[model samples]
Target: MKPLVSATFLTLASGSIGAQAAEIGATFEKPCPFGDCSAGIAFTFLGETSIQTGFSEADVEFGGISGLDFDQATGRFVALSDDRAERGPARVYELDVDLSAQGLQGVSVRRHISLLDVGDIPFAPQSVDPEALRLGPEGFYWTSEGGGSSQLPPSVRVSFPDGKHLREFALPDGFAPTAEGSSGIHDNLAFESLTMLPSGDVLVALEAALQQDGPKPGLMLGSPARMVQFDVLSGKPKAQYVYMISPVPQAGVDGEKAMNGLSEMLALEDGRILTVERSFAEGAGNTIKIFMVDLSNATDVSHISSLARHEDLIVPARKTEVLDLNGIGLRPDNIEAMAIGRAGDGTEILLLAADNNFSARQKSQFFAFEIVQRLQ
Candidate 1:
């Protein structure tokens, strides 16, 4: 946390989307995702410095909220609620797009997917995966985290409305898959970030596992994180890209609670790939970094550059932790989603969102930045 950024008590602004023009706007319900003490904030950026963020869940609307997704077609949003677990219950709601409406807009329950529906995954006590969400190139692609103690393989399976689900194959045996928690099941593998390739392949992020010192399960060291390209047609890994973020790209990055954030990955229309990471250093509450990658130039793992290091459009947080803008321990207050969009002005914009961790301590907020031509 870089010295609390001097925050302004929350407020509401009503305008005709004119002049001061909304640069970015987000929508989210309560039981925010970052912490347990703060309300969730959300935003959707319309490029050209137009941003809008609001607390639509509990505090502002229903008095509580959870995980959510937006439907551009419906011009509305949906959130997940719960009966209470490590995370919370998996409740869903419908959000009205007309924020300009004065009085409180009522929320309606639509879908309620709970942890009990979580099957056999051995990971966090929570069911909904915080952060790692994307309108996957595969259309309707979302991910979940496992570890902590999940016996089920930490996997990312695509669940379709018709009941058709497609999942990446889990590593066989005690091979120990990497990502979230560990159920001690040999085939336990956790997937964090994911992107669909031009070839119709899915590039999935895998955080390799760690072996303990004492009995087979004492302290875990970690392998490394890599982008495993999978040929969906074959349901197997076709290629792997090592990540410098981890010491053992094959295992996982070392010396951390876990190689925390491998947020989201996207292959741009021009062929360049952009990836997001949350390197929460001691007291760095939630430090989000973006890397612009050129697969053509990236012969190996050594080719990725920090978006912050270069001048080409680096987007840092306008807000860090919900509590102490300067403190770290703030569990999950980082940008988990990013998408490149073009505005009405013919300018390019980068949109980002923070995972509230469904905790009252954090807010479900979204942010936006312009990836300068230099970074592009």
Candidate 2:
């Protein structure tokens, strides 16, 4: 949900300062966590663009977009901010998207909705790290990376379109924050990605492996992240699947650390899901790839603990690389959100948004890709 703490390393003078700037809060980089890079499956790259806000009509305090969703019925885009309330209240903005064959035409904020709790109060600044979001039948479904000290198990909640909290879902006890009596998610690395299945189930992904599962991702190995399918309407979990994440592509550069994790996900027809794996290194910039995960033959691991030992017992989701952000030649930032924006003409257009960390050095980036190949 937040950048890893930069580890101390020998600073190389040969690297560019811009690269060092990107390493702010970055941890020490390790080699490819999963040994080597697997070739990604191909997709037609349509167009791409970088969004510049705080200018003209686009002058909106729109940064920290940790989640994204498109309301087809309203032809509007929802960008959820992780800004607890520092700059303003935790909010989601409705936007008008202008996309043509030429590329990303333009995007403008139309309105904003403030998220609230059961007490009818806005989230205090830094109190909650709202990560992933999805459009739901009754309202919006979202996840929050509750802070470390609070012992708040990562949570999923339903909120009205106007930002009223309707209810919260129960998380598996293994995801508890304390490690004394129960296994738990690593602080700050809890729920970061979510999607709504056609079956009306809400699939939530933990950003990293649970503390008891194994060590955090390393260059020579991969970390097993869990995706739980919850029956949203019923407010109960239906199943869980293992979704693995490779270590950061490049460790650290010029003494800066590189890290990677699942940022967002979308459900497709059939029992498949689309996930965004985002990695970042100081000087290397950001690396984002879309992976198609097949849950058809996947085993439910909801009841399984310590995935490391049950590797042979758990049938993890089958993942195929779909698209790599570098192929488009745009300098990628921290791209943490994604959604299907439009589908027509035998292709689907995906809208991707980057979180700026509210840093002057970083620009909130938006990218568009016309997926020429449709998922079967």
Candidate 3:
């Protein structure tokens, strides 16, 4: 924990900035973990802060922030809650995250926008499980993992900034759950990651393997998860690739309880993506790892209905590990969201958020890092 400092307000001709700068009083730096560090970027741990549990605004309980996106034009962030309409209406919150040359200054909530259905009404309880979110050309694009037990299918939808329903994208038949458990996403493991590419396409990733793909990740064996890319205009899947999830980093007290999966992703300008893989064990806590995934040579498995049958016929996405939070000397929580932004000095920064599950023992933690690119 770091000492909290007073907030410094900044004003612009357009209006007053939403968040004020306050010092968190912590800093650290680590070089890239992979080969050729001189040609890669280093992560400078800036600072960290947390929102009090049970915090509320606009009548909505604020927690379960599973996805995030930075708004460069407005200098704000949109955080999506995976509440499933349990505490209140499913929603997204506008936040002002103060980042300065020194480090991450502070974070404040500005407003909450309730996501609506086709009739412009707020989603009913258990109807949708909103997860990953990203800013797109038309508006904000978000994902719903849906309820596997209740047989509610997963969805990717576009919503206006005000949270009004724009349209829902069509998904492939492979994503639909079946009563026999023969195919589709497993319970609570559907679309947990989403990103918009430079080509106006969007990609959504499953948190774990589908029933037909293989078994869930274990301490000794990894699983195969799917990443589907959709055409923004047609809302149709153009391609799908396999991203092999790592096995659980550590085993839990109960061997069957440990698990690992892909949680979030951010598309980069160089046709690569920054991926967040979160593994957790009941008593062992969490292990968060960052990887850069290159899909240039990945075989498109969209035409193949089942990856289990053609495991030897396809090429999975190539990935290179970048950062491991365990090695950074911080006890990470359930980190499920990631975003890229620029600090006041125009330096690229990386931000990560944890989903507390609204548990008293957990925390809504936020970590900031400066992306220091090294020269060759």
Candidate 4:
């Protein structure tokens, strides 16, 4: 076992985005002492940075970064903003992240692309809530949680690097949002996780249990979340699996606002996945947990319309707790995005981003971790 190390804090000079620089405060820590290391893999905290809340470029706001992915080809990071066109046009920003053996150096915006609809125009306000992003063979693949007020069903779409609409994958009927709430995804709890498998297939997962699947996660009982895998060539769902989400850790101060749900996922080259589950309470801050899930023995529930009806016969995906951020001795914000990147020496690095919700109280925080794998 690795000995516990103390935390180091640093205030890095602001990195320039276009012409303006955003101040960043960073913290560095050693490997998580409470993480599960029996699996021969571990995560060591590299460092973290927080951009100023109101950072902007070209008259567009730079908050609400709900989804993030690194592009090796371009050596840039693509960050999706879930603005819903309220602050500006829905968009994605390309970021340049500097890292080394010491830890994170700085982060800066490189480019901003406005997401366009079929009409080749930016989506109007209250029309889309993009939550997940992945770089694909043809273009960029992203998912929108959909809006209940606008009656927009959750969607998976591909677009050119310039943000031109390409095509959309047809979601299963169970994902459609309804006003009566008889069935379908709960409000603001649709698809929030997306990843492209090594085989070129696409996978998207729900944030929480669907209305028909079961009840939302509570203190004692977890919720059943669904994951749908689609064939990239056909844009059709090929398989679906259930992922049981951890219940809320603590009751909110108000007794009704605390919640926990799957936020994002990163597919490993070996067919496994690392999932991020984030919980937030009214008085307490966020609780972030990372789990490694293996789907090899998981039963496909594509034909099973409602998991609640056939709960007895389903085998949900097997998951093992990997890292719990609470043990790192730092309070985490609303972390909703995860991506894999590379350090200066080619070591694998894990990157995480938090959604500020365009609120002044919250922060646009980014974290980097070195991926350490021990050979047996």
TM-score per candidate: 0.51, 0.82, 0.88, 0.88
Give the per-residue lDDT digits (tens) of candidate 1, residues 209-272: 2222011111233233446566666656555554433221122235444234345566654444
Which portions of model 1 miss their true places by more than 4 Å?
1-131, 136-139, 162-189, 207-223, 246-261, 282-284, 297-332, 341-349, 370-376
The superposed Cα distance between candidate 1 and the true structure at residue 84, in angstroms, equals 9.3
- What ordering of candidates by lDDT runs from best to worst? 3, 4, 2, 1
1-376 in candidate 2: lDDT tens per residue? 1111112223222111333222211111211112322211223334455556443223447778889998877777798988767777778888777665454666677778889977879787677678899999988899997654667678998999889989999887677777462468877778998998988889999887888776666656678898888987778888988888887777777768777888888886544677888887787788887777778778888778778677466778888665555643446788889987663332345778898887777777887654322222
Least accurate 10 contiguous residues by lDDT in model 1:
317-326
Error of 1 at 305 (Å): 26
State in Å the error of residue 228, model 2: 0.6
Q: Cα miss at 290, model 1 (Å)?
A: 0.9
lDDT tens per residue, model 4, 119-224: 7888888888999999988778999998555678999998998899998998897789788887788889899999988888999999988888998888998999
> Which ranges of candidate 4 are over 4 A from the true structure?
1-39, 254-256, 343-347, 374-376
State residue 95's C-alpha deviation in candidate 3, in Å.
1.0
Question: Which scores greater on lDDT, model 1 or model 3?
Answer: 3
